[model samples]
Target: MKKNIFKIFAALFFIAVIVSCRKEDPLNVDFSKLNIDNPVANTPLDTWLTTTFLNEYNIDVIYRYNRFYHGDDRDVAAVKVDKVQPQMQTVLEGFLLPYRKVAGVTFIKKYAPKQFVLFGSGSYNPDNSYTLATAAAGRNITIYDLNSFDLSDPNTIVNKLRTIHHEFTHILNQIVPMPVDFQLITKSTYLATWTTKSDESAQADGYVTPYASSQPGEDFAETTTSLLVYGQAWYDDRANGSTAAGKIALKAKEASVEQYFTVNLGIDFRALQREIQEVVRNTYNYQQASFPYWLGQNLYKSLIVNAAGDPIYSAFPLSTPFSLVNNNMKTAIAALPYGLTYNFMKLNFTSSTAMDIEINFNQGTRSFISRYAYTMDLDQATGQTKFTIAAVGGNDASWVGNANLLRPAVQPMLDYLSNNTFVADWLPTGVDAVNYNKYGGFYVLGTPANNFYGLLGQ
Candidate 1:
């Protein structure tokens, strides 16, 4: 009887132990701290921010704090995250309390897309502890030079947040996906070209960036970044400097961004842009609030596609530069500078091949040649004039006003019968150019001295 009693007690105790051990709690599970930040080791970082941040932004974050490298015993700290779980009773009460009547699983399945990351101390990178989070593909983050973060520099902190959110926006867009046609631009050329080429060059060729020239996926991602993080104004400033080739690529990209945000993402890009500017103004307390973006926008407007969705092209078609001698020469020019108009083309052609010979201040009609400047071009085969004449320079760089000052000022007249046309045939073919603005225009003075800014007038 004693043995039987002892066996029963042991069995009961064993069952109790198993039950206790099997009980799972949401807060205490040990997460990996593999990145440079190593927040897991720095604090008892729980899943507190998980549920909290998501309720506000519909995001989820995953964390991994400590990591190790393979050979030299040095650490490469990068951030990578995967899942988003809700914790904190306070957040739950506020969110769930309102919807207490509905089922819990239903809510989880409906409204939110969880946000999570794996932050680290040692990177899986080649260099220092600099961190980069790609919210688009392979949803991972690698933070470098861990010590570099001041935890100060309000600007830096804000940028970091912005970068993370920017990548997150990309991922969401990718999943939902923009039109595949948007991804088709420059499908053959995307690399790290954005950093390499100047905006002037990009605009000339109809692209937003040299990198954007590489492929469509990159273009799409860049377009999303341009629209969301920097907003239309910043995008405009950056794009205004783009070359003719860049402009074409930019147009495709612009259309994609507009479609994605308005039709797909279900957000107002214009209102969002305003909201973004407001946030920046309020957060940083800057007097101008995106001073660079707004400043660049003025010049950008001249390029075409004003940030407010306006078209500045019809007035300046190369054919009717001043008024067509005919439309054939205008047809072959391909593209022209931004914001130019028939009213602006006040010059007339005096020589052959469509050039201008016009009076300056009503004093003398000087003979000049330009496809755009001299709208009327003498057709070699037909013995008739077709192209029109227009002014190629800005207020400061007009040939009649400051004929001797700037080199690019006379490009319209000079390039017509000169070597400028076939000067660059070595580049990619199938590229027929028309209406491209010169790299720059000349200005004679600012308070009696020469000064200039941007590609076109402000």
Candidate 2:
């Protein structure tokens, strides 16, 4: 009986220990304070980002504020939601499409930056200079200054495009290193404190810009971006204005860049340049930078009209107008008793302010010529030129008889030249941008439809 009682006591003790350890505390926590909701609901911008960039090219455009994506210490504002789409559209036109045409869509898919992070405010630096764009590991690009973006403004568009191209060039360099000779061209000119140097000084040292003097990598990027964005005319101006050694170095660097793109990247750099210039001229309306506007020579030795089936023949044909004037002169000459057959006519710009009209005709298998002189009031600033009769026979009194003999036919052509103020242009809208300087002509200032184009000459 004692043994049985001890066993019961031990079992009772085990039960008490188990009950003490399993005691339940009062539940005082409030469930109402807990927060739970879906953070992403497929907003339009989100959907667009996914569809246009991500789905199309495997690119992620992050315009929303995300501290993890930016520098830890820098204060950069997120891109305005409204500004995001327009900015991306510019990117699509100015950057992506150009590359897609020249380098191929496959090239963009393979080499283009995968992520693009945008900010509204400039990335201000301690040096008082703001960062326009940056690339990291050839995978991501960060663009700043979207708050003041103006899509309609050509300057704004070009500035943004320059930054984009500059950053992209860095990514390209990361993939396939720029030619070592590019670095060696201006090896001794690079500066650690490049901010101290002016752009003029940088050009003097063979660097394209002050920032390019920071390092060889930046030099490469700047050079490539400038050529791509500014076109060949600007480069020529820069080279022409640079020091002798700078000009040589700049040319070498330019050649090196062309070689790198052609050999390393398998891209036709000239075709790419032409393609970019076409957009700059046609889309951006940068006509002043075209070839014709910069020609130092004022004389046009020959005028060749665009024939039938040409690009501008249907809309703005000079051939028809020229033929009418020539035929009228022919009929008038045919009525003359000299038995002269009308041959051809020429407009010679002998000087900036002087021109000669040469009337060539055939009399009994022998050619005869008459020259008429005129003065030109050419306002290059306004691209308007006015012609006035200086002398009917020019410097030869003997030719005065022929000038008076053909008065009826010559008077009409003469009146046309002296009466109309023709505006000189490279036919910016009609012909290819590649032929801007090679061929151009003058149209009535207010009446573009009344224009005539020809081979621009020296």
Estimate, for each residue in 1-458, the C-alpha lDDT of model 2 and write its tens digit: 99999999999999999998896998897553552212254678788888988998999988877778777888988777788888887778778888899889889988999999999998888888888889999989999989888878877887788898899999999999989999999899899788899989999888889999999999999999889888776776677779999999999999999999999999988777767777776787664445434432353455544343256555545645555765677788888888987665666777767776767777899877776778877775557778888855344632686666667667777777778888776653545444544566677778876766655544
Q: lDDT (CA) for every model shown?
A: 0.40, 0.77
Q: Candidate 1: global Cα-lDDT?
A: 0.40
Evaluate residue 149 in candidate 1 and report its C-alpha lDDT on the 0 to 100 scale.
Answer: 38
Q: What is the TM-score of each candidate against the true structure?
A: 0.43, 0.69
Candidate that scores best on lDDT: 2
After superposing candidate 2 on the true structure, give the runs of residues whose Cα lies further than 4 Å from its correct spot.
Answer: 1-41, 287-318, 322-419, 427-439, 444-458
* Model 1 spans with C-alpha error above 4 angstroms: 1-51, 54-75, 78-113, 118-131, 136-147, 150-155, 192-214, 285-289, 296-458
What's the distance in Å from true for residue 163, model 2? Answer: 0.6
Candidate 2 — worst ten consecutive residues by lDDT sum?
32-41
lDDT digits (tens) for residues 221-329 of candidate 1:
6566555445444565565566556656776678777677677755555544444444444453332233322322233222111111213233322212212221322
